[model samples]
Target: MDLMFLRATLLFILGVYANSLAVAKFIATSGRHKVKVICFSKTGERAAPFIRQAAKDYFSEASFAYVLWREIDMAFWWNMFGVDSAPSVVFLKDIYSKPITYSGSFNHLQLVKMMDDYKKNDIPQLRLVSSMELGCDARGYSRSGNETVTWYCLILVGRAGHAMTQMRETLRRASDVLMVGDDSDYARNVNLSVAIVASAAMKENRLTFTWLDGEVQQKYCQFHLAPEYHTKSCGPSYEDGVDAPQILIVRYLRNLTDDNAKNDRWKHFRNQYLGDTKVASQLIARYPGPEDVEELIQWISHIVERGDTREFPYFTFETPDLVPEDKQSMGSPVGQSFSRGINNRLKKLHMYISDLPRDPRVGPSLLLAACLLFGTIWLQNNRTKQANNTPGDLASSTSSRGRARARPARTDDVPPSMTDEEPKDAYQWVTTDSDSE
Candidate 1:
């Protein structure tokens, strides 16, 4: 009977375990981007409605799920998925990797603010192109044979300073135009490749943008450019030979699986323009303004259609030098003193709260604790003193009472002589007056 009951119980537990696994798997696989809100059992019930509602309102694009804090098997999650917090939100973009965790309580406003920037977490930015990964063997070019897609890369090569800073901003401005389509039908077609991929339907960009650090990549940069316009030769002037920023466009051709008869199947295109002048001239017709980025996009589109320029790979156009001026003074004493004051205040605050007695929250409790401690010590001391006096008092009471005296009786007695010693065993007999009769 015992064994039969045990078997039935085991079967029920197994069913429950299997059901839980199924539920967890279903939740994991339900969405491209999953937001799992975790809270304690009591808090979970209260937060559940708000979480669901806010998730819909703020993160309408993502699928949301909820898990009780107790149900989150922290030991398993810590080892398998690296999750170890409650009252937290985890974003699981791809199910294979550990999710990004955002901990603590968040209201609607805070939640929206935190999540707005993260919605585009999957979008690709114009990152730095790696020459080593691409096997370009040269800077200012990305011609990796391993690439599955062709890339028309706009590369800015320069020392990392104020000038490169402007270039980075320009790339961002240009990307805004090139990565999305305007409302017009013609504009949409022009940016069709980018738009199609923006929705995540496509995996690669038809045209990409990136930059290279010239200071570190000087050797490779020199080899890629014409000998006359090398880093050592071209700068502010011919005499100085200082390194200056240059912009170049490289076209990498896709690798063919099977060779077929075609015009230069493996040909790579490059247009290395010297100085900021030629690049800026093509980008900005007159003075550099906000619209220059738009003009630059048009020029890039035209170049993509024009094919490789065989006549002159290198072009130099004379335009005003586009170096940005730094107007602010290097340092300010007032700013330094303000910073120092803030630091000193932080240090003082840290020191003040470093001990239990000093913290404002601990004041009342600490006083109570001190009083209890002294009270206990006083009680113990009194107890010890009383215990020590107890035995002494009892001994004095016994000593105060003299030895009891035996009452004398009238007796016929034999007295021992002074000169004679009494026998050790001899006893004297006394007769009482009452016994005399």
Candidate 2:
């Protein structure tokens, strides 16, 4: 009889498990990105409390790891994922190569899921024949390749100082070389592929410079030569008037001071030309930064209003430069101080123009571009930090989250262990009126 009872219990357990699987199927087929599991233990480390709260707060898909053995696992992670201190939760993924994110000393998994919204995760894809723009949403690999090399010259002013080291890394990954210092001969001569740095501390306004004789600097752009006004130059003088492809790069010194000291001619120019425009006068029409639309005019000048050039790819999204830690510098006291640091960031549009390869598989370039597009420097920095830390671990973490939301929930199954028979001696199954009498 006991053997028979055991068999019956096993059958019941199997039935229950089958029902649970069916219910799970229904839920998966029904909701998308709605399923979540709460994995936690009640009497455990701080991990449990956070999971409970996260789940209670409508983190409907939230969960816990229960931290079965804090020390064993902690030790493993410290050696494994570099889990140094408390408040550490990781968001893992099913994919093999991805990022595992940590919220902080007090990091939580729930926070990572919310912050790294599934939709926002993307990598750049190369167009093959065209340019591959990985960095900015507005950027894509675009090269007409049709235009003549209209102009060419080594440009200047590179990152002479910066705020962070990762910033330095980001800069290096962005370019082919770091513009350490002056490339005077390259600047003076033309057609050497190129190497130059911008020394904002001592800008020569070579852009505004007239020939050594007295004629204004001009280019003989195709169909329109004998030009009149100062512009950039590369190969032939206007006398030759040959049109060729032109490349322009703006490098910056690490530290910044008044580029236009006390004289302030730009201010005067703006006051005269833009004074009456609504942009200059009204708060409703605020000013765009110098890199994009002018401080005022372009704002009021246009009939149709929208975003400024800064929002575009070829225009404004530029990051800060890095100053080297050591240097034997030249220039003013301010310039000398910034001499060491050199973090270089190029405008996305220019990168598209430069002959750099396009690989969606790469990280820094697109990551930097994505940061610019989403306009989330902090979040990007965090991603980069997580990236640098526990490289393999982080990637796994993201894959887990992606898979989590994909799994369906089974909300209607009977509890686990429902097949056991009742104990005859220990408990009564029912009450009888006759027995009571």
Candidate 3:
């Protein structure tokens, strides 16, 4: 019985731990919960009642109540949301992603109001499409209208609010993901131009954005909607209240009024549905939910970047599901193409070096020149050494010759005073001296 109880306890703990991990992952990826206020011990206990009251008062349906700091992992928040300080308020659009963080203590009412305002502010009103106006001027750079007519244009046609608002918010957030807060000059200028195809534009060129009213432009709506719904018309007067907005892109040509001009340029002005799963897959490699604005904008940017005016002037946005024959791996072709070009250049360089020694005249001339240079240097060094030794050699030779001549001739070679004479004369001389004395 004891063993069984112990086993059950351990199993229960393991299950709880596994469930917690799964929940954490979901919270990190999906922004389901609205508010996650963290406070520690005494401070959290004191603020709990007020935090609950605030949620109850304003955001009862949407808000998450205060959580004890000990119960929540600080490192997770730090890594995910860049939140390090305690007693912080996290306002989320997508709880699984980065949230708007408020560090330190704050009033409950103010917190509630801030969250409420953030939700309300997400709706995007239609900005007038003109050659004179620019979309998304948050960073500043005005665009003209005439410039967009010649390039691809993404226009959201619908009534303001509801689905339109969600789409617009998604488009805006997509820029944040693609741009990633780049402040460099090139990124700012180039990416801004490409990204604004679905968000903003200048009258200068390339891509642009605009919207149309569903009720006001019924004919235009019906023309785009009929093919998708297989209906004769669309708008408020339609048989069903399926009054959803639609997205379309237009491509225009330049300086040609000939018959082939229509075939070349105007053929790509056809509408492409933004809600298509295949289209979304082209942008982020996964299907984005309706509220996934960031994913949607990235998709638009992908198509705009690949668009070529000379060839097609628009993007096919074809994915594997729609056209399996055209499907390709997710890796970019740019890197592979660049590597192949570099390899070709290196091979040419190797061939050029290998052929250098094959030039008959050049090889012989260089070798002969090198030999002559070495001979000249050797002759010069020999001459310098001989010149330096000339005086010392002469002096040494002169002293040696003088010492030989100064020595006396050998007297040993002279006859020894006729030594052949006998010694009898010496005895006779001694006797004469004695007689004289």
Cand. 3 Cα-lDDT: 0.46
Best by TM-score: 1
Clashes of 2: 49
TM-score of each candidate?
Answer: 0.29, 0.18, 0.28
Residue 228 of model 1: what lDDT? 57
Give RMSD (Å) of candidate 1 vs. truth. 32.4
Worst 10 residues of 3 by lDDT: 318-327
Model 3 segments beyond 4 Å from truth?
A: 1-150, 175-205, 230-233, 237-240, 256-291, 313-437
lDDT by residue (197-223, candidate 2, tens digit) is 222211322111000101111121211
Off by over 4 Å in 2: 1-50, 53-64, 98-437
lDDT tens digits by residue: candidate 1, 271-354 = 111111211112111112243454566556555554333222333333221111111221354554355446535543443344
How many collisions per candidate?
1, 49, 13
Per-residue lDDT tens digits for candidate 3, residues 1-437, read: 99999997787667557646754764453322233433333255655677767656644224453545533355544656656766777665443233567777777667767666665444222222122233322111123432222344455665533665555555445434344434534345544444454443222434445444455445555544446532322344355545465665544333222212334322212211112111111111122235454445546665554443234422233211111111132123455445443653465345445544755556788989999999999999999988787997788888989999998889988886766686766554444566688
- List lDDT for all candidates, in order: 0.47, 0.30, 0.46
